[model samples]
Target chain A: MTRKILRNVGVPILSFVLLLLVWQWVVVGFHVASYIAPRPRQAFLAVTQNWSALWPLILGTIRETVYGFFVGAALGLGLGVIMAKVPVLQRIVYPVLVLSQAVPIIALAAPLVLILGFSVTPKVVIVAWIVFFPVTVNVLDGLTHVDKDLLNLARVYGASRWRTFIHIEIPATATPLFSGLKIGATYAVTGAIIGELAASDGASLALYQEHANANLNTAAVYGTTMVMTAIGITWFLLVVGVEVFATPWQRRTVARRWRRR
Target chain B: MTLLELRDVAKTFGDTIALSPTSLAIAEGSFVAIVGPSGCGKSTMFNVIAGLLTPDGGDVLVKGERVNGTTGHVGYMLQKDLLVPWRTVEDNITMAKRLTGRVSAADREEARAVARQYGLGDFLRHYPTALSGGMRQRVAFMRTLVTHQTLLLLDEPFGALDAQTRLEMQQWLLQVWRDTGRTVLFITHDVDESIFLSDRVIVMSPRPGRVVADFANPLPRPRTVDTLIEPAFIDLKTKVMRLLHREDA
Candidate 1:
């Protein structure tokens, strides 16, 4: 099992290393303009050299995204379970939830900025809004997909509602909940970036964008984009790790797929 | 004294009446068989008696106490072995006891003991998907036993098995019934199985079912598969077929 986990982890890490090699060798070989594609070493140094400048902004984005992701996900999960179980509430409330999303998040971001004003609140709101729908839908599917035969078995056994939910519904729906969390994690990363971009004119990655544009530092612009990509990858891997721990069953399923191949 | 008695028990589904005022009395420790054509309320009669359904109007008495609205007090084995796929074989057998939170260490030990006796000792930790159909049926039967209910309700428990497995299970069931001596009300469409397993057999009409005839199996105790060829066994089946309006060789 340990070997299997290591092997799984190894593929992505190796891919990343090969990517960096291509990036470094390509820049060196092509003598690519620094503004267009800085050497891999320059991008690597960017994080450590500018730690004092970058840490605060990075932390600030993380804080907003994490906060919004959880708040929205928690609300979505609770509401989704209720909606799945109660048809009348579902009928009354579902369209509102659906309609809320059809209008794009960016379309609403401007008004949000106008009202909330260049604060952490706008970013958090973006994260929350983005994360909410996937969490709700996945959770609802998970909760509803509990087996009918199991329900009947429980009924025949005269299991109490609390016991039934704890034993049957929760375990039965574990995979779906993890799925919701993964979506929420992806949304959270996007939400943070959007929040940072929309909120302040001269701070964080967006600030780097401004400086890079004014100086015509195309490599710096690409470098900032590279940083963003790294953050996204880090956050996604974190979610996947948590999912593996939370649902070993999923890991077993993945292992089976690997075997089949 | 009757262990279970159904008085004028009827069931209706919307416009269709399934059973019409069917009454039955099963004595303590007796094995009673109910056989009828497809679509007959034979299964419904047992369902009503098992407390899975309420008669449109009537009373179900178990040990002289009314038990129609009571579910879980009677253990029922359905045609399909409804074992939870995620649960292990041992867990499947004691599922009801675990669910009700009454399955204690002693109860589980008893469940394991029963499984071991039934040739599933090796596969207790195995999942349902790993087991064969015959093995699944045995686990289902073990589940009914673990419920520890005095009245057992089985609806075609061996109906899904192949011929060989069916015969094997029928023998296993007979031994289990003989040893446990739990009052059993088994419903089936198979005529031979009805005669082979029952102390008394009740024959029913197709729809709006009623007990058209009852016969003491008259076969000797410790009956086996070979008993099907006995003169008395053939005699009993021939009589039931005549009542069923079917020609017999």
Candidate 2:
């Protein structure tokens, strides 16, 4: 058990520390100005010293990300089910979904903020817009690709259409749904950050980063970025945790494969 | 009593004639096996009987009722266990019941009892991924049995197992068949298996499949590994093989 933990947790920490060391060495060895590039130690110091001021902005961005993620996930799942069930709708809306992704989120966010005014609504919309595409596409793929033999078995057993969808189709789609959610989780933070950068009268981590950049406080800028990165990682880990809980069979399958090898 | 009767059933997929006017009847509480070459419409016939495919002509009568393009008359099993990977062994076993309607406490009890009887009690809550191929097939069989259908159409249920596991599963299946006494229409390519497990062995002709020969096995009840070498079993197997070879010719 301890060995498993060491492999799981220790290895990533070790690699991350190595990266930090490399970053610090490059900053010091190059004799880079603090205004241009701060060392790892300076970035950490900046975050720790200014944590009191940065906390609310971090919380605000996190709130935006969380709210947007749930809204996007719900919408994506609903649309995906609708599209999967109705082939005509899928043919009509699928291309539109792809096009929505192709349009730059920055451009979309600016217009959204202008229209919605300076509130969390625009940020949530931006985040949802960014998060929905992966979720929808993955869900559609998952539903469409359910094993035909299982469907046949369901039919032979006289499963109603609703029963088949709930018992067979939904469970079959869980893995792919989680796949989209994980991808969306990583994008969610970026969406919130972009939304804040576009226009935020309220205090936000992105605004803090902009202020730090304008003052040439590169260490503070890096610190804000690190917090954003942390939030992104947290969101990703959260999705993974839920996936692990929801799909215990997947882990068993992987473990069985490992045992065979 | 006749449990299932297929009268001149035909299925054609565009230019390809999958099954050409096939007729057969299965008696209640009897085990029957159909042997045919690959692409000889064994699956099409099974699908037709299972109501997955509407026959181009004739009727499928289950217990004297025509059930065309309608399902739930028979429990069907395929070569692939097709157990839902996410569901537990007990869940997989009771899947047919769950799918058909609300599973009662008695239904769950029956599933538990069946699992325990079949030596899957300890793994009731275990997922299919954790089970072996043979075990998965057993779970699939249990799933079919719990559907409460008097007739079962098993399409090469043990075809994917290794030789040793296949033999074990055959014996296990025979025991289950004897215990349950459900009418079984088993499809396989193995002549020896057909003679061993079935009361009657059916041999189908090549593509656009039709039954060319149906032989009643004279082998006694409680057949075992020793039965494989018995004169009656060998004789029946040889006759089935010759008939199959003639079709190939």
What are the per-residue Cα lDDT tens digits for candidate 1 across A46-114? Answer: 656777887787777777877898888888888788987897998898899899889877778889889
Which residue pairs of candidate 2 clash?
none
Q: Which of the CAPRI classes, incorrect, acceptable, medium or high, describes model 2?
A: medium
Count backbone overlaps in model 2.
0
Could you tell me the TM-score of chain B in model 2? 0.98
Q: Supply the global lDDT for candidate 2.
A: 0.90
In order of appearance, the predictions have TM-scores of 0.83, 0.96
Off by over 4 Å in 1: A1-7, A10-34, A37-42, A111-122, A200-261, B234-249
Compare the candidates by DockQ and give the number of the best one: 2
| DockQ of predictions, in order shown | 0.32, 0.55
Off by over 4 Å in 2: A253-261
Q: Write the residue-wise lDDT of candidate 2 on B21-127 in tens digits.
A: 98898899999999989988889999999999999999999999999889989999999899988887877888877777877778888989999999988887777
Q: After superposition, how far is residue A243 of candidate 2 from its true place, in Å?
A: 1.0
Residue-level lDDT tens digits of model 2 in A26-68: 9889998888889988898999999999999999999999999
Clashes of each: 2, 0
Residue B13, model 2: lDDT of 94
